[model samples]
Target: MSARLEVADIFRRHGEAYRQAHHGHLGRVERRVMSAIELCRTAALGGHIEECRACGAVRVAYNSCRNRHCPKCQTAVARDWLAARASELLPVPYFHVVFTLPAEIAAVAFQNKAVVYTILFRTAAETLRTIAADPRHLGAEIGLIAVLHSWGQTLTYHPHLHCIVPGGGPSPDGSRWISCRPGFFLAVRVLSRLFRRLFLEALRVAFEAGGLQFFGSIADLAGPAAFARLLAAARRRDWVVYAKPPFGGPEQVLAYLGRYTHRVAIANSRLVSLADGKVTFRWRDYRHGRKTKLMTLKADEFIRRFLLHTLPDGFHRIRHYGFLANGRRVARLASCRQLLAVRAPETAFRAEPVTDLPSLTHPCPCCGSPMITLAVWHHGQAPPPRSAWNDSS
Candidate 1:
């Protein structure tokens, strides 16, 4: 709740030593993440003075690190993303579907993050579109908003995709709308079976084509025999594909997006304390009735777990598919609104800035007066340039 219990506090106090100890093992991008978290919203990044127009109150506004991994800055990112998505909401019901990789696949994903993660997205989208159009299922072309989450409740490496789909879709012939049964979508068991088959088949193709990498503990899997064994074991197991009931309406879907989009591994609110070289934080023990518990780890270990979710540079965690595909979204959305007989936001209302917008950017903390920017504060160095996070070698 306070600065003492925030992630920045822990990083500021212990990050330098942790970086020094892990110098040889950590990548340049990982080190940059540590540096950004350590200096987030602090005097080190510089600050600007703002003066209240009515009361003459002066306030110093510190610059945010704006790193995607920084806990303090992701809130704004989530807000902006959700705001953009608000108008894209359809009048029909929405469903939440999840696609998860098994531990064996997750191990390979750890080494080949960009490749494996991209494969995961592609496989998931293909499975959904393929099954939903089989004539036995919905038989409509569904739209989905998929988000990639790589961490479990305790910050463990568990790669999964969270997909928000419409309950129905446009007909295959694009002649008319097709809607699923009320409060029901595709069957989860069928989805899981198809998803497992498609992903394993694609993984086999990537392996035979020399697209995947292996190293350290998994070096043996690079061989054809070892890789076949891996695939066989994965095939025998049931891949998890969880589907929840449809959301009540568009408002509920927007509320759900606020939580997952652009989220970091851990939030500042969960941190309880950092003392005696151990950082204590609240975590959910999902296996045990979802019990609330406290977990403490050494300073170095804490930082290590936190950095495990840092994505490869330019790797998009959130992806769109089917009707929501990025290239076709604008035209498809406009067509969908017309077909569904719903009005777009701009067409429904006049375009004027909301009255409450100013409170977000320029408001006096002391007096409720409008605060104006006094001067711009420039940092000593520019933010780190985007580069590849790891080398294949």
Candidate 2:
């Protein structure tokens, strides 16, 4: 019955002040994010009108910026994406794996977002596929849908990939389904080591190809020696690769994807208050068993923290690999389903009504007759202004 204090509210209240404080220092990404948040769901972008004919109800629907990083827009998009993906899930146990980069690599990823993030996906996928295909492991080509998350609860740059992989896969020989032992999936220790090596190797390749950029505090890392030292440090430390126990069934995987796939740094419901120029919100400390606690941050500081996750333009955070690889996904996935003895799903999930809009027809202003479209107006340019009669006439 009460209003929720959201990150948007904080941005609405103090985003300008924050911008002023960081003026001449804000990166392109952060500046664009500020503009998006302040103008989203406002009249600046124009809108559509929906009128209920039966009930005399009218609603003005504002346009969304449709920025993937915007919290308000991500939910509906996430839901639609989940619905499409739901049918691809096999009717078997699914495992959740997380591949995390060390803080050192996270620093590099912050600097070279598109390149490093792509490397993260490729390396993690390669590690999983290679390890899964080995005779010592499942010896089957597996499928995984990976989603990249760049922020932790407090909105710091913590790059990690979350993957949902089916517990079993078609055997390499194509004779049968290969199932792993119950309660165990891929070996995390092996995954961590392979992930480290592959990611570092890929990073070296990216650097050589001039696909990386360094700035600000990360400028020193542009040198090979410094980059090598960073890699060595990552290898010396334990890379975190965690595997959650098998999910119950296929439907559960749909629910899981709905939450994780398109999540932003924070959600609207988490905030409790915004008063006295301070924002208070609840966050779960995952390292401490999901303990919930309230944290208060100055309004400007809150926006600063929230802006830390503004991704590079057109950067794709989610990726598919192995059997789900782009080019061969259809064929490979069909073979997998046949071998697993599971038929493809009969119907896909639908989160909304498919027929929400009326067919296009111009209602005549004079007689209320429906006017069929004879031609389309191209480029939306107005017709040339008509010329008045000649002066001689």
Candidate 3:
């Protein structure tokens, strides 16, 4: 029942040429990703290997890559993650904020992914914390779960941070839980201005500390004046900081995280066709309210686009800070929950939200209406033995 066009499909078609083109220059991660994708659902990794009882249909089931970049493998990963995080969800409102670099800065970031992207995360976090802690604002310590995304739907380099934030936070003394206004979380305009200033400041520091390198057309930026001019040009353009209303509740926040936390440059569900050495797929046009549409690209072009999002070795895309910080998360979370006076609710966190909700709003694709949950799937296993088949058969 998998409708996905997985990495295995692409690798089966073109991994050999790609490996040949890179050869010894290939990093361990890229090689591993390629190998995993190639072997994903084939007979290489053992599984149930189901066959239809009535028909002669046969299928091979194998293990997943579990590589963070593999789109087809994110569902279970997201569900497991959500289950673990469900305990940490406070009853307070949660907001979604996005910080995006201007095109000029993004160009430089594309060249120095690890360094520039790390700086982007730091500067954005600092900007939010500083602004939120000011006496004029809520004046409390904030927390965030920031996920970095490096590509647009078409796999272009579009680095941005997607933050899932609790609407308020513990006061500096930890006495009370501060809450933001019902609708307004933070000011996008202020966040944008401050983010631009802080990021440029951090970039200058990185350049002076010999953290940046330039080649090709950008080589001239090695000079302070050239870099200053670049920064000034970027400053003249508007940096975008978009903040949306609070996600309705914990369930909604988990649902949102499930989608974004493990997402890759593209997903299997988006691929439409592969024929005649060309690939066709769907992508979102964010510039126009995310109108969905289809696009076609040469096979080589498609591979190139996919490779554009290959992250630097050992970089962590998903991060937790403040209350969710690894060292402090447990204790702080307990205190926060106590302050909020609401215990985390118990639910089927491992199930997909669409499946959990009543199907009236989202009709089943197979039936065009609500579908009953006939069963729950366990990992690499079957449902409990049915009575009729237990002894009679």
Candidate 4:
């Protein structure tokens, strides 16, 4: 049987060529991403040996790269993250809202990622809060969790925020929980207009403070007149703010969060093949009835598109705002539960105990018994010989 293909496979096979072709253009983050994905779960990074306590069956487990952008590394990370979030789910209905930038602004964002992405998160959250707080609307403070996704189905650079918000929040007077109208959240038009104005204003401020940078095709924007024109053109367009129907309940919201929170540019399962100097992958064409289609690109182009979504060092892609903001979350949640007369869900996550041989999360394949680590090795070191264990790579 043929081994499964992964993003790591593509990087290991064609990465050096891609690096050579685009050496002048690649950034530090992109280079590191390529290297991490290529070396992930490989002997170069080292591994440990485990034995079933009952049957003595042996297994070899590798260390993960744990790079946020590596597709192979996010599944376990997302699972752990969602487990921590399970207890935070409220009993109220939740809404999924998205705020997307206009193409002109997205072009500017591609060059100034750290500044523009931060602006995107802040303005989007502010718009939601401002609109929901209006007496004419819900008139209550709402809490939301926003996640940033920078790639489209075809791996194009499409920057947007996916926000999950509860149906309501504590009233301004703190007397009661104010629920939104049944089957309705804030108006999309209001949200879009507010988001656009706030974002453009923020961009103008950043430019004035010399916080944004431009290069290559957009180098002309370094001039004040050209930059002003770019903002003016963006202002003339209607920004997109989409609000999907409210989720059935908190359970559905958790499932949805699990899928979106730690997604990379593309999952390994999407790759159909890589052959003859081209890479083929599956993508959903949402504009065309949500049909699944095959897209093939030159190997270099495929690598380029994959690296386009690499985030800057220490940049956060997930954030909480309003009542869910980090510092006040525990207190606000306690107050919210009291208002709603519901108990918080029991937390499902517990910190694993530390020891010389850490416990493995998985059980032995042959005997279904607990597996205990027998030996460990660091990078550049080889594990002890175990004839029973097969190397999958």
Best by TM-score: 4
Q: Tell me the deviation in Å of residue 70 in model 3.
A: 1.4
Candidate 4 error regions (>4 Å): 347-361, 385-393
Off by over 4 Å in 2: 356-393
- How close is each model in CA RMSD to the real structure? 7.4, 6.8, 7.6, 3.2
Q: Write candidate 3's Cα lDDT for 331-367 as tens digits.
A: 8888888778877566557555554342123234443
TM-score of each: 0.91, 0.87, 0.82, 0.94
List runs of model 3 lying over 4 Å from the truth.
Answer: 1-4, 19-28, 44-60, 350-393
- Residue range 1-393, candidate 4, lDDT tens digits: 899889999899999998898889888999999999998998778888877878878777888899999998988888878887888988888999999998888989999899999999999999999999997999999999999999999999999999999989999998999999998999999999999999999999999999999888889999999999998888889999999999997678878998999999999999999999899999999999999999999888899899889999999999999999999999999999999999998865533443563655468899788787776777888766666443432
Give candidate 2's error at residue 16 in angstroms.
Answer: 1.6
Clashes, model 3: 0
lDDT of 1 by residue, 284-338 (tens): 9878999999999988888888888989988899999998998999899888887
Candidates, ranked, TM-score: 4, 1, 2, 3
Error of 4 at 289 (Å): 1.1
Which one wins on lDDT?
Answer: 4
Clashing pairs in 3: none
Q: Name the candidate, 1 or 4, with the larger lDDT value.
A: 4
TM value for model 3: 0.82
Reference-based TM-score, model 1: 0.91
